[model samples]
Each structure stands twice: as structure tokens, then as C-alpha cells.
Target: MVRESLKILLTSCFLLLFLASCTLGGGKNGKLLKSTGQPYEVVLEGDTDSIVTKILTEEVPALPQPEPLCRLIQVKKGKIHGSYLLVRTRIVVNIPAAEFSVGLSRNENASPQTVIRISARSPQQLREKLNPEKLRQLVDEAELEHLASIISTNPSKQNREMQQLVKKNFGISMNIPAEMQASKKAKNFIWISNNASSGMKNLILMKMKEVKSEKRAEEVNSEERRVKKTDAFSAQEKQQIDSMLRTNMPGETDSMYMVIPVLAKRGLWEMKGDAMGGPYVMQRIRRGKTGDEIIIIGFVYAPEMKKKILIKQLEAAISTIK
Candidate 1:
């Protein structure tokens, strides 16, 4: 367990620093500003039932995204700008040395946003969690001083080709990082079927995973129905939920905590672990979606002194998953 914590600490160090979709800059060749040669405004509105997919092709990857956690959903068209009446499911996966999130955005200033953002964070939380006293014993002020830059920076960026799609879900973009190399890219985001997992990691990912039109529509309908119910905690109970949201500094994430949609049913409260040097704390906050009878799933980890800074990074990480 102690040795595992050390590896997690190193992972936290690498991933949190690779912030995606939130950073900025692209000098030439759209190097920093990923530009795809595709048209910007997609006006097709009839039955807009289409699929979106993303695949990865890389060797010796630093981290691997969990399969089930990554998925697609078609959002209502009008919710986002210049989007077809359809949207895809959005998800983010955190792997050692990588803080990754993917999705489409609607209100973003840019159009056609099928992008990827990665970031890095402090490993202080990991060491503190693994062995607070031992960490203190093994490392002195000199080592602590070297970690200054890694903790203060955010490194989000834009993936040019899929910007249209990404913008519809994630709503924002970042400048690509100069430090990391392009691991790989897929010709089409949606290509393979459910059985695609038979191939090696990169092969499976590089070829987008496909879902049948009927099944995709069914999932979307089920999702909508889930969100259509209109009941919530009583007036007094909501006050309590509000009370929790108002407080909670959540030392490890961004300032945008507990912002559930005002009119949806079945609100979600989430906070997940940072996989620091030790077990991460669970951060929980509950709020109902104004009127949808939807079952919400969340990922919130509690706050702990060991992972003071690292928790915030992971918090920021999951916050991007909507």
C-alpha cells in the first residue's frame, strides 16, 4: 500500500499539471489552436439522430481511461449553439500522468468543439495521504520548494478536428500544451461496435466505438425521461441543500462547485478521490434537477488534510465532466 501510494503521488503530479480545454495560445499551423478544415455551423435538424465517437492509438501510454466511464449521449439541439438537434454523452477519465476530459459544448463562443483538455496537479496531497509523517521525514524544504510551479498552473487546450462537437458539450476551449507530444488521433470518432474491445488498447480507442441507432435513441429517451420528473425536497429541505452548497471550500478543486441545473429532477452530489498517496476523501453535495425525474450519478471525494491541494485538482477534473 505504501509503495502504491508513491506511484499515485507521481501520477497526481503528472496529471493535474496537464489541464485541458481551459488553457490558451496557438502560434502558427494552429499548433496551439487545433483547427479542423470542416464547416462550422451544422444546420441539419430533421430527426437529428447521429452518433459521435473518439478512439485512441498510442503505445506506452501514461494512463488508461476506464471504459464504462467514457460514453456518448445526444443532447437537445437548441441547448447548444450551432449544434444539430442532437448531442453525445460526455465523460472524463483520470489516469496517471494525465488529467483528461472530453465532450461537446453549446454556449461556448466557438463552434464545432470536439476537443480534449489535459492538466497536472500537486503531488503534495498524495505524499501527505500515504504517510504524512514519513513524507515529512523523507523530504525537506528543498524538495517542497521545487514543486511551486506545478501547483499554480492550469493547462487546458483545444482539439481542432472535433471542436464543433466538443463545444456543444464542454462549452470552453484551451490552448494545447507545448510540453506533451500528441499521443495519437482517430480518423473518425465513431467507428467500431461494442465488440471493438477485442483489439489492443490503442487500436480499440483509435477506432471510435459505435452504438446502434435504435439503442442510442433508446438511451437518450431513457435519459430524458429520467430527467423529466418534477419533484424535489420540500421548501425547507431545499434550504438545507442550499446551505451545504453555500459552504465547503473543497481545498482541491476550482471555485465552480455545486452548480446543479435549477429545473431538473433527481439532483446529483459528487466528489471523487484524487488517488493521492492515500485514499481520497469523498465530497458530497445534493441538489435536485428542477423538474426531471432523472437518476443522477455523481463523483465527489471527501476533503482530507493529506490531499489538501491534490483534492482540488481532481475536483476540478470531475467538474468538467458535464
Candidate 2:
């Protein structure tokens, strides 16, 4: 008997069919229970004699409020279309069933770097039903933050770094190695690898993550000032810009489109293609007539990312992004 137990795991932000397992029951004495020929709910009506043993044997995490389920999955008898947010990473996940919904909040009390806060209670239910061990391998904010922490957020007073020294401007700090390269091109700031480290839980050092491409003078969502200026990029120059957006970003990377009002209006895409995955990363940059451009930063993970945790973790990481 095939019981409809749909397991939809929401690891990070990406959605994959992780154990879309259909639990089944009935057929005692090799006989069907009902011939309604429709999906019917199964209720277990039995004595509670073994309640104490079952409870004792059941797996209950010693986490504070179930650890926010690094992954959130919702499986109805079939599939329930919905959107769930990975609060810590801020990735908004939407399935075919629902319009875009963006109501996700991180648990200030969670205090776990890798934790993902799911918005809907359904996802919470999904999280509760699934096995916990299945989630350990996926990358989560806790891991990324752990990786980010290994790097020195403070920049060394070194001169002539590949990346112009960003004077700790963004109040938010990251674990960038003092030796890791840095550059500040215009309003945007970038950091790259100078040394590789194994313990780096985040993808930064693994060469799995990097600035796939950076766009300048191009406008995204806004029209460029059409002043009588010959310095405007030519058509062929524009194709080079268009080609940038040919592929989807790896699931691990986030596409950040920034609008710098005073200095320079621009959009930036960061792509990290982990070699473990099919490819490195693809940064898709496109152009708009009004000087606007769209940057798609993709992190294509190994099919392993398709796992609930990686998808949700990447989704969570992407969600935290603007």
C-alpha cells in the first residue's frame, strides 16, 4: 500500500526532489482497505500501549526549537505549490502553485549561523517529519558564516592589492584573509582568493565562489543618462555585455543588483561555480535600452546541491541578498 508521504526538503534556497517519498500503509492480509479510488486520508486508530516505548525511541533533536530545520519541505498527497523563505539566507522559494510571496523573517533568537528560518508552518511540519541525518551534508549559513569567520574581516594595511583596499566601509564584516586580494572598483567592492584553505566552510577559498563578472556604466532597472556623450559604449561593446548573461548562475551564488545613486548607478553579479558541481559558475548579464542591465549570478552545484540542504542553504544565502 502506497501511503502518500511527500517529503519536500527546503535546504538553503534551491528546491530539489529529495526523497519525495510516498509512505504507504494498509493491505492487511494482502487486501485493500477502501475502493474509493481517490486519495483518502489514513488515520491510525490503535491502542496507546506502546506510546512510552515509541516516544523513547523517536528521534528528538536537542536543539532549541527544532533548529529551524536547515531544510524545509512540504509534501501533500501529491505536491503543494507554495513559497517558503530561508530567513537567515533570505532566499525566497516559490513553486508552480503560488504567486511570488516574500514574507520571511530570520529568528533573532536562533543564534545559529547555519540556521534557516522558514516562514510557513507547512514547511515546519515537513521539516519535522523528515529524518535529520539526511541534512548533515548540505551547506548552510552556519557553515558559510563559519567559513566567513575564518577569514579576517579586517583588511591589512598593505599597498597595491589586486582589489583596492575597501576601508571597512560596509559595517558588516566577513572572514576575508588579510592576504586575500581585494579591489574596490567604483562604488562596488570585491574580494578574491590569494590563498586556499581547507577548513574554509564557505566556498570562498575552494575557488567554488568568485566574482564571475562585474558591470560598469551599465544601468539596471534605470535608464542611462542620454546626454550628448560620444563615450557611450558602441554596439559590439554592448554584445559583449549581452553575452555575459548567457547561462544560469550556479545555485550557490547570489545575484546582487545595486543602484548607486550618487557615485555610479550599477548592477553586480557574483558567481561561484564549484568544480565539484557540473561546472564552475556562470554570471549572466543582460542589457536594457534605458541604460539598465540585469546580472544573473549562478552557482551550479554538483547534483548534490540538488539535495534539500544545499538547495535550501544556497537559497537561504541568496535570500539574505537584496
Candidate 3:
């Protein structure tokens, strides 16, 4: 069954590539590509109860907290096209009638385009034969590719000076836009934001001393253990974030402050006394052997703007951590 599925997927991808190449004009094909639609917005083209839909929309509870997979990615479901035949396009998922086939295709039309094709003889067959965990992983992998492609198509010049500043101050190396400047800086915290009239894209970096324990040190750092540690640390991180935001990230008024919702790894934040808010995602990673941990927070503050794309841009920029 797996072999058959692979065959179908490969053939479809090849056919789409051929058709796209034949149809597109030369200069237009090589033109600077700009990512369209909101970030993490998926063009789902499948039955409402299809396995692909079910897996992509599943609630992910394994994090230090629980949130829907779509929420974590800030995925907004686009208009349904309901056809797998439209593979010669950008980030799209096509669900065809076949027997368990799934594959990702690139360069189908534009320079940095992607198409995820999933098929099965029936939805029931797909559910029976598929591993939900693997399917969830596939979505995440595709999301990274989609993000990278967007950045590639719309390249941002590296702000070397800002990079140096961050390294000197925060002891971290990551890419930031040349125009983005640090609005706030502290011994262990920095807030960098881009100057966009429509909306603001911001990134916060906070480093703290990880508490040392004999049991924690002795625990094998496997993937499972790492997840457990993150789950435990998530609460602590949230408290720290709340305190930081209250002190550093002041709102329009003194009464307004940022608060992390209970048992949430991501949520919308609103200024208490002001009518301003947007989405946010927080993640924690162990930095070094010196018992230091890094807490990365990316947020959006576009009152009347769609935030998924900007939040995604912030995520992509931060992902450049080497």
C-alpha cells in the first residue's frame, strides 16, 4: 500500500510540474515572488471530514500546555477549492480519490511554491492506516518549508549592526530586519520591533538562570524528557513573562498590562485600559551548560490588521538562531 501510494504521489507531482512549466511565461516565472495570503493560512481542498483535515485541525495537547495545531501555527482556513487537481499553485493541499498517498511538491508554478497532496481510497481507509502523530509532524514540516519559501521570495537584508548588538547584549545570534530597532533593552531582556505603519512585528528575548537540581541534571535529555521539562518550565516562564510585560511592555495607560492566560502556551493579549491586542506565541529552550535558558516570545499588535503573516515573519526571523 505504501509503495502504491508513493507511485501515485510522484506521478501527480511530476505532472503538475510539467503543466506549470508549460503554462508560465519566462520573465514572470523568475520575477521576485511575494508570498500572498495570511501566514499559516492553509488552502485546504478536501472533504469536510477528510483525514487530512482531521489531522491538521487536531488539538495538540502534548506541549507544556494544550492548543489546537492550527492555533499554534496561527493557521486560518482559506476558501475551500475542493479539488486536488489544482496542484500547480502555491502552498495548497489537494485531497484526491486514491488509496493512501501523501507527498510535498515544490516549484510547481512559482519559484518558491509548495503543494501538499494527500489521497486515499476513502477517508476511513486513511484514518485506519495512518498514524496521527506522523501526520501532525508532516504538517509542521510543511509549515517550515512554507515559511522559508516566503522569506526567500521576499528577502530581507540582514541588519549586521543590530545582530552585533543582540549578540553583545543577549549572547544570541539571529537575523533581524535592517530597519527593525531595539525599543527596549535590559541586562537579560530585549524588545525589537519593525516600523510598519499597518502593524507592528515584535520579538522579545529573555534569558534567565535555569534552576539546578540533581534530579534534573541526572535525567536523560531525550525528546520525551525535553518535552516534560518544557511543560514544567512553561508555567514558570509565563509568570516571568507576565512580570516582564507588566514592568517593561507597558500599554498606552498605567492600568493596561499584558497577561499570559492560564494553561496556555499561546493566546491573544489585550491592553486592559486600551483597545489594542493581538496574537502571541511563547517558546523556551535551554541555552548553555551554564544553567541558562532562553525564552523567546513573538507577538503582533495590529488592531485592524491580519496578524498571522507578521507573526509568522517574526517566527521565521527568530528561527535563524544558529
Best by lDDT: 3
In the range 104-185, model 3's lDDT, one tens digit per residue, is 7765444444566666666577677667787666655556556644444454666677778778876777777665764678
Task: Estimate candidate 1's alpha-carbon lDDT, on a 0 to 1 scale.
Answer: 0.27
For candidate 2, the lDDT comes to 0.27
Q: What TM-score does structure 3 among the candidates reach? A: 0.64
| Ranking of all candidate structures by their lDDT, best first | 3, 1, 2
- Could you give candidate 1's per-residue lDDT for residues 197-249 as a string of tens digits? 12201100111122225643454456344322223334443444333432431
- The residue-level lDDT of candidate 2 at 12 comes to 22
Per-residue lDDT of candidate 2, residues 177-222 (tens digit): 3443422232222324332232111211111111122344343323
TM-score of 1: 0.17
Off by over 4 Å in 1: 1-178, 189-209, 213-217, 222-322
Count of backbone clashes, every candidate in sequence: 88, 46, 3
Candidate 3 Cα errors over 4 Å, as ranges: 1-98, 108-110, 127-140, 149-156, 195-197, 219-231, 234-237, 263-265, 272-275
Q: RMSD in Å for candidate 1, one decimal?
A: 26.7
Give the candidate order by descending TM-score.
3, 2, 1
